[model samples]
Target: MTTQVVILAAGMGSRLGRSLPKPLTELSDGRTIMQQQFDNIHHAFGKRAKVTVVVGYKLEHIVEAFPDASFVYNEQYDQTNTSKSLLRALQASQPGGVLWMNGDVVFDPRVLDRAAEMIARDQSFVTVNTAKVSDEEVKYTTSAEGYIQKLSKTVKGGLGEAVGINYISAADKAMLVRHLQRVDAQDYFERGIELAIEQNRILVEPVDISDLYAVEVDFAEDLDRANLFV
Candidate 1:
């Protein structure tokens, strides 16, 4: 099956206090977050998955940074959330399984390598960190068999953070797109996935990535913390 990767890179980094968009934000390592993410995705999928980056804020910067990447713009980026950005990407994606990640995280590239293998076996799942988690992150709980039962920022005493990485099988694309479209502008992309699971449209297992270092860079402090990991 063809594998496609969609990157949600359209957000303005308001919390990071940078004029750069979140995807264009430079790390101490001199690589922008989008560059790091693209490298990882490339390493994992090689020529297997075609990648499409969704861009909005400072669209020209991202376009220049990744001239080769297919892009779907989210014109209402300032007014919408990740769900809307993802919806546009889904509409543009070819028929295939898709792997997606947020634009603002830095992590070990091997995580996606491992995720690629896991998704080949399971078809659908969310990459999660099973170590100690915080209330500030999107959290989830899994059944003993590793299928995610619930996911939310308020999922108290949950298993781990969602890590903003997820996969969907091509077989579920139509249903997934329907769920994404039903979500309101204020809701997260995860909300649609949750609705999918609730309605028995899909089953998203949890794949733990505790062995690898990954962090969503939401603020200056988060960037500092991620520096230590990289």
Candidate 2:
């Protein structure tokens, strides 16, 4: 089966203050953030990867930049959050596992190489950076069994920060979709993952990638930090 991948690029990204979609923002290396993500995906999965980007704000810009990618438009992008965008992508996907990342994240391709083992085992996971846990970023804590328990911005005693790279196995995809629907429109996709763990007992492991560079570019400072890695 082909490896399904989704890039959530519909948000207006007002924080970044860029006219183009955040993913299209040019990096120091001249490759856009989305371009680096595509290169990483291809390097990790080769021709087996089927990428679907969820587009909205300035959708045409992204559409023109990556002509080969499949897309799903989120009409309510301005009114909704990642939960809705991710929900749409999941709905459009075939009955299989999916690997997704926030469009603005610029990371070392080796991050995906680290995740390849978990993907092969069909396990659900969230890539994390244990080196830092900022109050603004999504954080998480694991259950006694070492599976992710609490996952959100307000998680107390957070073990690490979720780096916006995640996977949902085929077995857990439907449940995640149902939880995504239940979350509020303003809620991040992490809320749905929390609900799934709380209600359905889905096991989501935290794959630590602190040794690797994975930065989600939201502010100018973040872009600066990400550029250092690239």
Candidate 3:
């Protein structure tokens, strides 16, 4: 029941005003931001999961930072969303279930354990959420029961930022690839999962991770605050 992690780290993160990719940003700990994330994940899963990081923008720095992790290049990152970035990573992963996540996102290691526990329970879909979004705009929309109804930016009363933690079981892997094919290359990955759930082919197991402290930085202010997670 080994797991494989596919981290989508191919974005330019223009919001961060950085000439480099977000993952390569410096952390207070003296390690690059991505290195801190790996440190957290490794502390949780150890060698139980083979980790593969998908790189596109400033990929060289990413390779240099985490040389042991497998790497996949996504040339389309500038034009496409994370779904495609992860698809490229999947092309190189073990055929087992995947713990798919965003490299730029920060999450508590407990969220990783929760995701793995749910996936091991024969769940077809798994995610983490919170109800603490302060913005008038909703970052994501999910049912009270934790089913993500929509991931659009316009959706109000947003459930919260998607924790970006997931468990893609082996049985659900085909569904991921098929959804990518049916949808255009530019479509976001979560939208495909929602569509699959409409066909009753996916089940989302939600973990209320509001208590966990995590953050996603696309700005200098956030970079200054990253010490909360580190």
Scored by lDDT, the top model is 2
lDDT per residue as tens, model 2, 1-230:
78999999999999999899999999999999999999999999996699999999999999999999999999999999999999999999998899999999999999999888899999999999999889988999998899999999998899999999999999999999999998999999999999999999999999999999999999999999999989
How would the candidate models be sorted by lDDT, starting from the highest? Answer: 2, 1, 3
lDDT of 1 at 78: 91
Q: Say which prediction, candidate 1 or candidate 3, comes out ahead on lDDT.
A: 1
**How does each model score on lDDT?**
0.85, 0.96, 0.71
Question: Which whole-number lDDT from 0 to 100 does residue 208 have in model 3?
Answer: 66
Q: Which candidate, 1 or 2, would have the higher TM-score against the true structure? A: 2
Q: lDDT per residue, candidate 3, 169-216, as tens digits?
A: 677777776676577777667766766666644656556677776666
Give per-residue lDDT, candidate 3, residue 204. Answer: 60
Q: Lowest-lDDT window of 10 residues in candidate 3?
A: 129-138
lDDT agreement of model 3 with the native: 0.71
Candidates' TM-scores? 0.95, 0.99, 0.87
- 1-230 in candidate 1: lDDT tens per residue? 66688999888879888887887877788888888888888788776568898899998988888888899999998999999999899889877778899999899998898888866874788999988789888999876666887888878779889999888877766787898899899788888888887786477878788999998999888899888866
> What lDDT does model 1 reach?
0.85
